[model samples]
Target: MEMQGEERIAARRDIVWAALNDPEILRQCIPGCQSLELKSPTELSASVKIKIGPVSASFSGDVVLSNINAPESYTISGEGKGGIAGFAKGGADVILTEDGDDTILAYEAKAEIGGKLAQLGSRLVGSSAKKLAQQFFADFNAAVSAQAAANS
Candidate 1:
């Protein structure tokens, strides 16, 4: 599956970049995220629970950020196991550009699933993924906006 989208954050590029890389902020933005640990500058371990269609599962995964361009763009990838439910792996290329007083965050993502998750059919899985992505960005935008407000 493939997905791409963008959001305008009411914050500067640097602030947005910093927030995006922060585990605390990510944990708040990620839907059903139980924990997020930053193992290194570019590595993270996480546990998240999700319900897609009729299947509900908790997934533990490792995320790695590549092609670091400090405050500009990077590629993030990870894979998760959902016990008997299935497994999922995905990667996203994210870019940030300054737009007036805001930052425009753009991303292109691709994902693949196996086992029971794959059996759920592409339409259902894809729809769930899209909703999840939307929810993440909405939360992210709100968090960044609030942070920016607090700093001002």
Candidate 2:
């Protein structure tokens, strides 16, 4: 599945960029995230538990940042294995554009799933994925804005 959207965060591009790279911020922003640990500057290990329709699973994966352009854009990709439930893999191209004191964050994302998840039907899986993505960005925007306010 594929999705794209943009959010106007009430913070500077640099602050937003830093928040994007911070594991603590990401851990809070990612829906269902149980834990997130930075393995390196460009890599992280994460565990997330999710429920789709009637299926629930815990996924452990490694997320990597690539095609990086500091404070501007990057591609974040990861794949997770959920035992028998299935596996999910995807990537997102994120771009940050400055607008006054705020930052415009845009992203184009694509995902693929196999096993029981794929058996759940495309409509169900697609809608759930969209909702999860929306939640993540909304949480991220709130976190960044709050952090910016606190710092200022």
Candidate 3:
């Protein structure tokens, strides 16, 4: 499925980018995120718990950031295993645009699933994926906004 959204964060692009790259901040912002570890400047490992339809699973995987453009845009890709639930692989292009007094954080992502997850049908998987993405963005925006407020 494809997912996209934009969030207005009350912070400079540099500040926002720093937060985005910070694993600790991401762990807190990611919904159902059990853990997030940065292995390199542009690579990370994570585990997240998710409930899709009637199936509940925990997925762990490695994510790599590529095609970097400083304080602007990048492509992120990852492949994760969900035990009997299935496997998932996806990539997203994140773009940051300058907005008055804030930054417009936009992303478009494509995700693919296999194994039991693929057996669950597209509609159910798609809806759940969309919800998860939205939740992550919402949490991220709130966290960043709060951090900015506190720092100001």
| Candidate maximizing TM-score | 2
Q: Residue 33 CA error for candidate 2 (Å)?
A: 0.3
Q: Evaluated with lDDT, which candidate comes out highest?
A: 2
lDDT of 1 at 19: 96
Q: Give the whole-model CA lDDT for all candidates, comma-separated.
A: 0.95, 0.98, 0.91
Model 1, 1-152: lDDT tens per residue? Answer: 99999999999999999998999999999999999999999999999999999999999999999999998999999999999988999999999999998999999999999989889999999999999998999899999989998998
Query: Which residue pairs show collisions in model 2?
Result: none
> Candidates 1 and 2: which is better by lDDT?
2
Candidate 3 residue spans exceeding 4 A from truth = none
**Where's the lowest-lDDT run of ten residues in candidate 3?**
11-20
lDDT of 2 by residue, 87-119 (tens): 999999999999999999999999999999999
For candidate 3, the TM-score is: 0.97
Residue by residue across 38-151, what tens digits does model 3's lDDT show? 999999999999888888889999999999998899998999999999999998899999887699999999999998989889999999999988888889988888898898
Q: In model 1, what is the error at residue 86, expressed in angstroms?
A: 1.0
Off by over 4 Å in 1: none
